[model samples]
Every structure is written in C-alpha cells, then in structure tokens.
Target: MNQQPLSIPADTQASLLDVLREQLHLTGTKKGCDHEQCGACTVHIDGQTALSSLTIAHMVTDKKITTIEGLAMGEQIHPMQEGFIA
Candidate 1:
C-alpha cells in the first residue's frame, strides 16, 4: 500500500523516537533506553518493525512512520492491540 511521506524538520535530530515524541507529539512510542538496548521504542516504518530509538528521523523523512497512534482507524483499535487483549 502507498503511504504519505512525513517530513521532518532539518533541525531535528536523527533519532526517530525524539522526533515522534517531541515534534509529532506521538507519545505511544515510548523511550525505554535511549541507547537502543530496550525494545520499548519499537515502531513500524513502512510496515516493517523499526527501532525508533536507533533510527534517524531525517533518514525516514520520506517514509511512513507508523506508531501506536497510527494503528487505530479513528475510534477503532488496531489488530495488534486487539490480539494482545485476547
């Protein structure tokens, strides 16, 4: 599926976690260990599992950065969240 590109400010740091939390205000992508030791900052970049903490924001500027917030279709819950509850 084709996704829209999310532009990141040039001044922003390379860390995807920081961009999402600070710039985009997507707090669902938690930051456990900024050193990329923990998997808490896991997110999907273009439908693939990505460690936002490790990835640079600028590198993925043209890519789709899917966080926990983007999972839901409006009020509906995403499949991942639903599966976890079951």
Candidate 2:
C-alpha cells in the first residue's frame, strides 16, 4: 500500500480505473468491461461499492477511493477478503 496520497493531474480525462492502474500501478482491479456491467472493476468509494471504470478521475479528487490493493494492511487481511476465501 502507498503511504502517500496519489496526485493526479486535474486536467486528466482518464477513467478512474486507468489512473489507478496506469499511473499508480495498482492493478488489483481488473478491467472486464469498459461498461459498468461487470463487477471486475468494483471498488469502494467512501465505503460504497462503485465501478471504477465508469468513474472519471477528475471527479474523484476529494473522495476516498479504495481498491482491492488497499484492503490489506501489510500482513493482515481485511474481513471481506477472509470471507471471500471462506
């Protein structure tokens, strides 16, 4: 996990998923469909499930975006992750 907050260009027209993967190199969220139909791009935005692919990067500047990569704390796994395993 990154200790510092990511700073994306205000003028960037990339999708939230693109910036998360291409810029920050956080690729845990996969791109299934560019459309919002698939759950592969599902992530938490302020604790609510959202489709990253359908979200604009500039619009989420002040929001807390949580990708799959952000769920774990070093060696500790999140409860949701453990549930998926079980």
Candidate 3:
C-alpha cells in the first residue's frame, strides 16, 4: 500500500499517545500503560471507542478521528469532559 503523509504536528513524539497529548495538546487522554494494556488511551474512531495506540497513524487518513482536542467548539467544553470535571 502507498503510504500517505499524515499531517501530525512536527513537535509530536512518534507514539500515538504522545501525538495526541503533545501535538494536539489534548491532555485529557491519560497514559497509564504504553503497552496498550490499560484503557486510558481510549478514543472514538469513526464513532467507536478504540485504543488509539493500536491504530496506525496512516489509518486515520481523511477520516474524522475524534480526540479530546476536537471535542469542544470555540468557547465550550465537551459534555463528557465537563461531566468528568464536575
């Protein structure tokens, strides 16, 4: 398969968790085990909770991958995040 250049931020670490936390700066997604044992790195892939670490970076090509980053609009927080905080 031809590899496409995924536009993850330059400063992001190579790991999937690191990319989400550092580049996108979505700190809500925790990192309990880098081994993908714990469910802390859970995220919705095409509307299903998936272990982001197990997914290849290129697999998300042109697809809407919802991270903790894109959960909120300009000034609003996602209900899920707010519920956790509350």
Which portions of model 1 miss their true places by more than 4 Å?
1-5, 82-86
lDDT of 1 by residue, 1-86 (tens): 11445555755565888878887787878889877687789898878998988887777756776787778777899897686458
Clashes of each: 2, 0, 0
lDDT of 1: 0.75
Residues 1-86, candidate 2: write the lDDT tens digits.
13456667734678888888888888878899887777888888877888988888888776788888788888999886686568
Best model per TM-score: 2
lDDT at 17, model 2: 84
Q: Candidate 2: misplaced stretches above 4 Å? A: 1-4, 79-86
lDDT ranking from best candidate downward? 2, 1, 3
- Could you tell which candidate, 1 or 3, scores higher by lDDT? 1
* Top-lDDT structure, candidate number: 2
